[model samples]
Target: MKKSLIVSFILSAFLVTTLSGCGSTSTAVSGSTDTKVPATAKTEKSTTLRIGYQKYGTVNFLKANGELDKVLKEKGITIQWTEFPGGPQLLEAMNVGSIDVGHTGEAPPIFAQAAGTPLVYLGHEPASPASEAILIPEKSEIKSVAELKGKKVALNKGSNVHYLLVKQLEKAGLKYEDIQVVFLPPADARAAFEKGSVDAWVIWDPFFSAAETSAKAKILADGKDTVANHEFYLATRSYAQSNPETVKTLLEQLAKVDTWSKDHPKELSETLSPQLGIDVPSLERAAKRRTYGIQPIDDALLSEQQKIADSFFKLGLIPKEINVKDAVLPATK
Candidate 1:
């Protein structure tokens, strides 16, 4: 009987030790799970940021200076800068996921929106009215915006300068059908203008300034009294929505570079001239014409953007109407 009791006690002791060990392990696991992980610690670090830039903008300036790379390096973010001839092409790249963010004039995003591209407007450069203009050969007989009627005018269709041409025509009391519109990109338009194939060229700088300096082009009218010429920064909707922090960092860097560029136009021109293959003087003039104040898209800006969209739709530039506010990125999200 004692032997039987001793065996039973040994079995009980083994069971108790095993159960206690399991309970201790369970407690440890629960404690580990209960510990909070920091949001920053949990976030997956973004390694590369793909940026689409024009030859003449804050993004280009940042690329030229390597400032953005320096700013983002500590966060494990590296910049991949891609140059687009124009905003329309840049936004197209964004739609295809080739680029994560882009800098463009106001109109390309409108056209992109109409085309069902999922893009969001994150921010805007301040009004730069003097930077874009409709130019005539210095010796040409055409004197005013009214004279553009019945004359062939060249501009990149759906470009910001397109809006300037429309607004200038309206201000001159001319209908859209009154003029012979020639759709051409800046390079082709410059070629046509220089070769006297096109009577007038509506363009934006550094092309505008380059034409003035190199081609001896005369300004019929610039955006000063016409368009606000608000440059926009855009991102793919998926990227903007999913990676708000990354977008914010990009905007902040852009703003910093803009501020620096505005204050140091000479330095900026010197730095960018070789990179852009444009002369320093023209670049200096172009740089001076731009405003460095990058602002958040707000009600007043949206109202202006809406007018642009509605005008384009009515003029048959776009297939359908769109709400500018629909593409605005929420300040937080």
Candidate 2:
């Protein structure tokens, strides 16, 4: 009799909830949390938020003129966008408090945090090792990673490729000091690699793809096992915590653009090509290889990121080990 009474009560509650949820237009957070908003109700505004982004990373026109801006605009907030060449520079800007939010890859944030940069990882993206690599001239004599010893390799120092080259050398049983590291920007490195000044170029796509097709560069090795090459959305801890409401809407919009980009790769390239001034073909090539979804800052992801920083320390690229979770916002987990 007691079991039957409990079952009856449960069924009654389910029936009530089922009927109450009929034709719902807004997502209800909980039984008591109000989610319904009148059409005339304006979303309350919040603090000023500045977002930074690089040309080749996730922050293209997606933040500049797309739905993210529109989403935030709807909430009566304003966003200021600052552009960067690479993650290292962007982190530099962040460390100096030039901006509050930006997107970068795994390695730069690791290096930046090691050097006492104050950026925090808010979230991440799906891992894709193919996004970064080491490219050589197609007909070059360097057939194996071992042959890179004493060879001039051009790379952006302290960027994602910095750790990649270290791991590549270690895989070949070579010490980090065995190779001549030529630190160069992407543009200068392309020129130097083309002029035969460097034996190989360690770079990320669409530069890697361009080097393969137009520059006739061969990929000697890629991020395989060395990295997952996951893109990270970082922000100032103070900024993210103080402006949760603004950040929440902005992240949702980012996820929205990511979903749309996945379904419409060609559309994404067509939209970004003109802004980047890099032709549709190159943009399309990049879009094909990249995975565009933001990830919550789960423990597993943080563990992997910590390993990345630890590896840099083991290889002597960094003087001391950094607790990656410390740099991560407290609300990160």
Candidate 3:
């Protein structure tokens, strides 16, 4: 199936899988939605903790360290890691109960919430505004954001770059309808952009880094100048509420890995090069574009997430308004 068609099907089925026997909601003490794990579930002591992660990012770093395996093994729990192409797909797996915890860019959670997926915000990475970009071919005559008007632009629908593209267009005094958006995932979009099938492509690293070097693409704008591009960690409502200690342990391990990643980018890149199948320098370059820190969900973070929810709703991209605060896990003491 075409990528777009597959994405559409996933989006359409999102609520169906989430609401139909997959999840149940309880009223929390704070009046938030507390989604409980499905009943025919194994105990925390009996089952493996399934974590879905994108091919790059923190989970890859965590997997490389191998500490998570040793730690979980002590608790009679094993780790099962699933790789996803991006956040949207990762969250789809979560909604279907295929994975218990995952990480994604800021936008996916908002889309998931709007689709009625029972998810909780577990944590987030500090904003790394330069990690994503809007690129025009090196020789393209379209120079400024305004020039994108009436042109075909390629990007993954509902991805982080989708929010970036929307905000950038508004900043350029263009309406959502002003440009032609061709919704394609990164690989296909890169192909379209290189062949001049799409005039511009909005994407995130390490794909953004790879394209900049391999395709010699020139950046028209980057997230640094436009949006607060924060990546988030999430869990199915049931999993987080039932496994608080496991969640805390996961966060602790992630923090150590993130701190180490910052201090050893070259070494980190060399280690990840084989796993990601990218050259060291490109991975190192991608490393330079990110900020590595994890933070708990808070009001300030929810405010930023609210902005994303509102933007999509305004654009008619999401079906309804989303209250980001309601989906956040209660503060851990």
Mind giving the per-residue lDDT tens digits that candidate 1 earns over 1-333? 343343333233323322322222211121233222223221233478899999898888878888778878887788888998888888888878798888899899999999988787766777999999999998899988998889999998888998999999999999989999999988999999999988999889999999999989999999996789998888775555445456656766676787789899999999988888899999999998888766655678889989999999999999998988767533211
Residues 1-333, model 2: lDDT tens digits: 343343333233323322232323233222344343234422333456788888776666376446777667777777788887788988889898898889888889998898887666666778878878898987799999899999999998788888788888888999888999999988889999999999999998777777776877888999878778888888765565455556666666666677777778788778777777666777778788888766666578889889888888997888899998777432333
Each model's Cα RMSD? 17.8, 10.5, 8.8
Q: Give the TM-score of candidate 2.
A: 0.83
All candidates in order of TM-score, best leading: 3, 1, 2
lDDT of each: 0.79, 0.73, 0.80
Off by more than 4 A, model 1 = 1-46, 331-333
* Backbone Cα, N, C clashes tallied per candidate: 0, 0, 1
Q: Per-residue lDDT of 1-333 in model 3, one digit per residue for the tens?
A: 443343333222322323332334433333444545457633343257899988678878998889999998998889999988888888888888899999899899999888888888766778999999999998999989999999999998888889999989989999989999999977899899999999999999888888888889999999876799988878887676566567667877887898899889999999988887777887889898899877655568788889889989988999999889878643320
Measured with C-alpha atoms, the lDDT of residue 256 in candidate 1 is 71
Is candidate 2 or 3 superior in TM-score? 3
